[model samples]
Target: MTQVQTLDRTGTDAVAKAWTHVRGNLRRSAGQRLFDQWLKPVVLVDGSTESAVRLGLPSSFMTQWVKNHYSERLLLEFRAVLPEVVSVTLETLSDEPQRVLKAEVEAPAMVPPPASAERPSFDPRFSFQRFVVDSTNRVAFNAAKAMAMPGVPQFSPLYLHAGTGQGKTHLMHAIGQTFLAANPGATAIYVTGERFMFEFVQALRSRDTHAFKTRLRSVDLLMIDDLQFIGGKDATQEEFFHTVNEFMSAGKRLVIAADRAPQALEGFEPRLAGRLGSGLVADIRPAELELRRAIVARKLEDMPAVDMPAEVVDLLAARITANVRELEGALNRLVAYANLSNETITVDFAVNTLGEVLRSAQRRITIDEIQRAVSSHFELKQLDLISERRAVAIARPRQIAMYLAKRLTTRSLPEIGRKFGGRDHSTVIHAVRRIEDLRAKDVEIDGAVRALMRTLEG
Candidate 1:
């Protein structure tokens, strides 16, 4: 073979070996679902040169995502295999068939692509400036801002936990972006708990464990979101604990997000949970009606031309309480539908378009809210309703609260009983039964209970 041909063959052989290791590592690093969906479809192209390797993905979207999220790691992996390698890029594969043996990828655990003049790792929409802060999430919002600001990290390993779409991940992203802006050139790594576990496992499989540790620890800031995924994962948790210790010891800041507070992370290592709680633990409560309304208005502001009726805005804000993400989605769907129809949006239109969302949102109400609503409707203090007062004035409202708590909220009998001044499950059952019979026989009691139900439901 000529020298050029010989060089090509050598490069091809190195890449082939690199691909085998990279693929295995990537499979472990990215979960099987992500690997199969995004990475697995990528094929090494025929025109791939030695210094600049090209990975061809199935679609433009996949190509862009891989380039954004995985290109840095791929470049590092390629350099390890071929010392002369300088760049790794992802391109959309052609529909026509090609020779199939090129399955390997130059793979390392993803180092997020270098940030552009504009933030790269974080979604522009998820910045602190755009986040709609209200009483529900103000503490978490402030804590996140503090973590992002330059200076001593007031709280290392700051843990922010909340239900889905309540902005926990958004806070992490904001912290990362702000941290980078405050301390330019500082390294920040943002990953999910599943991704962390996958990458650690991949490193172990590929015997690249040291590189994994170095890559993770070398970072100045590490943010892990959705940590509940690694709860019972022993080995992953072991590596995570060590990573946490090393970062804390070095005074590097860590930001973590989960679905529950540290104490509620039942299966997680107790020590790890305790360590997470050692830093600031901020809870983001479910957004209230006023906040939800404000979010709807802000979402509408994004499309200034779109006409969202006052009633429709009120409908969405009042109905969609599950999370800001879902709330946003419902609005998006409504606007898209409205534009398609070229008609005015109405409460009726919104109800029809988002009937399922409205139903789901209804289920978001808490037992506390139910109790408060019943107490308010009867013009009795909330404490009187839950206290041991046996007077008809308090007892009637108390029974109605218990009835609504059972009927509306998903709390169990025992749980609902505990909320009502330590009453037993039997008392809750009796209250529910008494209310049901009263609704049938007594007109005044029936009207009052029905009014309370309508008030709470609305």
Candidate 2:
């Protein structure tokens, strides 16, 4: 009878209270990074019965992640809190069934009518002011700014390429915002390759492609992102080639971004690749340790309450070498967990709190990877680096390879030297020193080294 009275209490209230307690327990036990990333967003759905519990997540991917990792744990936690709870079910907060995550799919694209006065809003957080710039992305940053200027840009088709989360999209958004501000009456349109193909197909189906072409070409500044996705779409490529011609011929500004250089795009026509590369092709290199630290500091400025220590900052920057997004994510996770647990931010706290994340971010780059990247960059055979050639053409690339090996790998100098033709530790040291000095004084060498590092690290 007492248990019946307990069950008589509104199921919503009882379940909500139990959910809150279970979440707190999970947070404390699962560690901050994993809890916040996967379980924090979970909500108790309204379909719970006396024996079964339903939990809702925003998407299928998250549902799957949590279900795979914490289903049994969740069931145990709920049953511990409420003896009547017999089962836990995780589901997406949607009517649709779970779908497999796949590559970017083409869909009907929406371009604002040329006659429409309304403008698309740019993400306020991604403005140029928020961008952290250094040697790695300075050229692309400057070129993006130049494209946004009032008059015709110095470069007609500014092509920007970088690995994911490397600020290519940030630069594109900044360009759109700046261009609109500089020319109040001008029109700017941003679309991804998938969207471009989608809109084109929609136009084809509706037999209204003239409007599509007009809407796209009539814009004053047109920016395309994820251009790699459009490869092998011939009909879409034909229209795109014309769009590029229209902009170039009309002197309108065009900016494009992809994950790789134009020359490396697979299944792309040579002419389209050439057209995209005809203008200034700038690459956003991977963030160096200094730049990464600066980014962490800049991010912290936004969270004034989170007083992260300097060593923790250094450890994060050094360990999370993957990309800017992960680096910032690590910092945010650390700050959030510390706040939740009321723990002071320290190097040890960061390490323990972000153990899983720190390990995953530490991608071990090998000397073989570095050598391959350098050899490809210098157009030398892979063995040429480890061979006995002393020609400046081969020797300089070999030195660069040795320098990269020492800097990028955990291997000792002797191990690195051994990889590079069994040279002595002194030889490896000299190469490292020479490259370091050249990186300071010689722009070309510095640029080459930066490119190589970006390739390897990215």
Candidate 3:
């Protein structure tokens, strides 16, 4: 009995020492940025045995991400340090036991299961019911819903483009979920660009490329998010081009999303870009002020217990205009800290708790900056904007500059007029009204304004 006790202690010490060595290996191999974001949070859970090791992450999402990307690497690292270490499992760091994401006994065979196997499940929170529609994303939302409905796809590859944290992934997940619900036996898969590349590389190393192709081609619906990550990967691009062709030929639903339009994707093959843009291409603009306010109110409605003041709501909606994720994160932080401290959810309390976030959110753009951005975008000289020329080329750009100045800056109408070659305040008003009306009817003008606003705000 004493011998067994000593052996157990020795094993525990060995595992602890092995974990330290493994962490160093991971940091050096994964690089600094990837390590800090995903791997740094992993902790060796208590009660791990010699043959079975447990790793914990803060959230299920992080756990899944780490599992998908680093699980095999982690297991190999542990075994190299301590040969007895047989497995490394990932789970959320909660009191309740999470679904254990088990690494394979060896490396995963890049081969996927048969077509009859269960389809991948999407996040329940990202259903169509949860998505909020507005003028900015209504077209994309409607297209997603239409694709998910039963019958033939109206468009082969529905392309969704937007900035980060904007609703691309959400809509993709919603489409997968709704489609699967409507067609219970249908198969669907959602993979990030990075994950697809990782799997493809693994298959190449294993000499099992056929299995990978079959797995993807057999799916009824395929949605790939963040296609920008696979940039410059020549082999992956070749495989992706073929995959796109297969989907189009089969009339299967193929959805892709990226930070920019297909034509704007750098290092991508021209043929691939042209094929991707051959179908319906929809862009989700940044949420306007009204939509942001509505989002805040919608979030508040979910938390009935938290008595957030109207002033606080307005403050959050108006200030945090970067993305919906950041906006919602600020609100969550305020609510969580207030709950922990048993403090009243007042405007003053919110201001104090979210000082750094609010400070970063306050980006004060000037009229001069707007004029320069607009002039540069329109290929007009700065002098042309302030000149008396009324040509369509010059006058239209000037009106756009005035409209942006009004929307992005806090200057009064008279102040804006004084800066624009001493025009009357009425001219500025007409420009604002005319641009506003044009945005509703003219896609090109709206796209230009959205692009200018994003550039100037940054």
Using TM-score, give the best candidate's number.
3
Instruction: Please give, for residues 1-458, the per-residue lDDT of candidate 1 as tens digits.
Output: 00111124544776666666566555544445456667887666654576777677767888887887788767755665666777877777666655544432344333323222222246545789888998779999999998898877787888999999999988887887788878886777778888798878877887878867876777788889899999889999999999989978887789999999998996798899889998889999887656788988887788999888775776777667668898899999989988998868886788788878788777566878987787777777888877888998888889888887776555789999999999999999999999989989999988787567556655
Model 1, position 243: C-alpha lDDT score: 91
Task: Please report, in order, the local distance difference test score of every candidate based on alpha carbons.
Answer: 0.77, 0.80, 0.81
Q: How far is candidate 2 from the true structure (C-alpha RMSD, Å)?
A: 13.9
Superposition error at 209 for model 2 (Å): 0.8
lDDT of 2 by residue, 351-403 (tens): 79999998799787888998889989999999999999999999889999998
**What tens-digit string does per-residue lDDT give for candidate 3 at 181-227?**
89988988777899789878877986878867877888899999999
Better of 1 and 2 by lDDT: 2
Candidate 2, residue 164: the lDDT equals: 91
TM-score for every candidate vs. truth? 0.62, 0.60, 0.63
lDDT of 1 at 44: 65
* Total clashing pairs in model 2: 0
Task: Kindly give the stretch of ten consecutive residues in candidate 3 with the minimal lDDT sum.
Answer: 1-10
